[model samples]
Target: MIITLTLNPSVDISTTIDHLVPEQKLRCAAARYDPGGGGINVSRAIHRLGGKSRAVFPVGGATGSLLEQLVAEQQIDFQTVPMAGWTRQSFVVTETSTRQQFRFGLPGPAWSMDERELFLNTVLTFPKPIDYVVISGSFPPGLPADYCAVIARIVRQRGARLILDTSGEPLRMAVQEGAFLLKPNLGELASLVGVDKLELDEVEEAARSVIQRGWCEVVVLSLGPAGALLVAKTGHADQRIERFRVPAPTVKKQSTVGAGDSMVGGMIYALSQGKSYEEMLRFGVACGTAATMNPGTELFHKDDVERLLNWINQSGKKVFLPVADGIN
Candidate 1:
């Protein structure tokens, strides 16, 4: 089973206003509420693509209760660890005239040391044999800097592959622990490799460095509209490392929210299906680009992903070795 962890979940409130004039008592359309968090959204997208994943996160207070209700409405299976603080909410306001979107996020409640232990224990004690464990989103306050590393060890002990999608120090620490794969954008990748920034020509070399160091088995570099680059060591000892670039499909733009998480979800779903790495990356780019065609935090539609995947395959994208038809 695929399991996702969102350390800090949220109740996302999005609305649109005709205009924004300073302190003018601006009015907005009726607010729309959706569950918001990296891994949570990944689970949501996976479900959208006809897959099942259990979402595990900490919840507290009335807002937490509402968050659970919202997720339940989406029919995603979940387990919540009790917490001492209320779950936070985020605001997304769009200016209809200019199509400008503004997002405001609130810090989550700090967890005490004891509370943090319980949280980790909850994940460690997951009953089933987890095939994939996805840990994404920001580290909640009061959590240790190496929290992802701790989680990496737990999942490793269970013999489950880990998919890490996080940023900053936690990401750097987690990479050292190693994982099945990582999806880091340009900026996050630069930081992990100790660079101020990376030029276009430096991406492949930088990504190759990460894999060469054995930090992770797979590194998927997300290049936004340009596409993604996949670099990895060969499974056979004598075989060489390989790289593939899946170009992004051009589409009308909307809100970019949830696109990255959707991309991660798509790749994970493809992996679960025993598809090739090229297929996984192709489907991932398809999902991400599709997500950008819609407004708000809404993810991609399955139909859109299917069409884009067809386009990618038709455009002669690079291929990777296929997985066994029956690996179960």
Candidate 2:
């Protein structure tokens, strides 16, 4: 089974405005609310694709109750650890004129030491072995920076694959534990490597270096419209690290919110089905493209994913870059 752990979850409210004028009171044309966080988004995307996965999260107060109801309405399996504080809410505003999105996220509720211990113990008591344990999103306040690293250790000790998709200090600590997969966008990767920014060549070197240092078995650096690069740690000269550049599809991009999370979901869904890395990346890219066709954090449906996959396969223009020997 696939399991996703979201340390900080929220009720995401998304609204659409014809144009975003900074100093004015603009009326929203449309709006929607959903349970959101990186890992929850992953679970929702997987469910949309007819995949089964459980979302494990911390909840508190009325907001948390609402989030639980929302998840249930979507038919997602969720397990929660109750907290003393109220859950947070986030706002995502999409400008229709330019297809630009702005997200305002709140600092989540603080967690007591006892609450943290309970969460860790609950995670340790999974009823069955999970195929993949996805640790994603920001850590709530009062949580340790090494929280993800500790979870990674637990997941590793249970012989399960760990996929981390996060940023900041938690990401820094988790990398030291060496997860099975680390999916960081270019900016996040740059932060992990302690650089202000990276040029294209620098990005490649940083990704490869992460793999070489044993911080992660595989490093996937997402390049937005340019697609993603996958670096494997096998170190075989003939084993070329694959780069899949998904040219942004020609569509009315209503929103880019949750596109990355959808991609991760698609990739994890494909991997859970025993698909090859190449196939997984292709499917993931398709899911991301399909997600852009909508207006919010809403993910791609199964039919949408299939349609996008068909378009990608028909295009037949994927580029493959061979890894030079002895580079590591």
- Where in model 2 is the C-alpha error above 4 Å? 18-30, 97-99, 234-244, 317-327
Tell me each candidate's TM-score: 0.95, 0.92
**Model 2 residue 271 CA deviation in Å:** 0.5
Per-residue error (Å), model 1, residue 205: 0.9
| Candidate 2 local lDDT, 224-315, one digit each (tens) | 77767776654455544544445545666777778888989999999988987767777888888788888777767678778878877677
Task: Say which candidate scores most in TM-score.
Answer: 1
Q: For this target, which candidate reaches the highest lDDT against the unseen true structure?
A: 1
Per-residue alpha-carbon lDDT of model 1 for 125-237, expressed as tens digits?
99778899999898788688898899998998899999999999999998888898999999999998999999989997888788777788888999999988888765765
The lowest-lDDT stretch of 10 consecutive residues in candidate 1 is 319-328
Error of 1 at 2 (Å): 0.3
- Relative to the unseen true structure, what is the Cα RMSD of model 2? 2.3
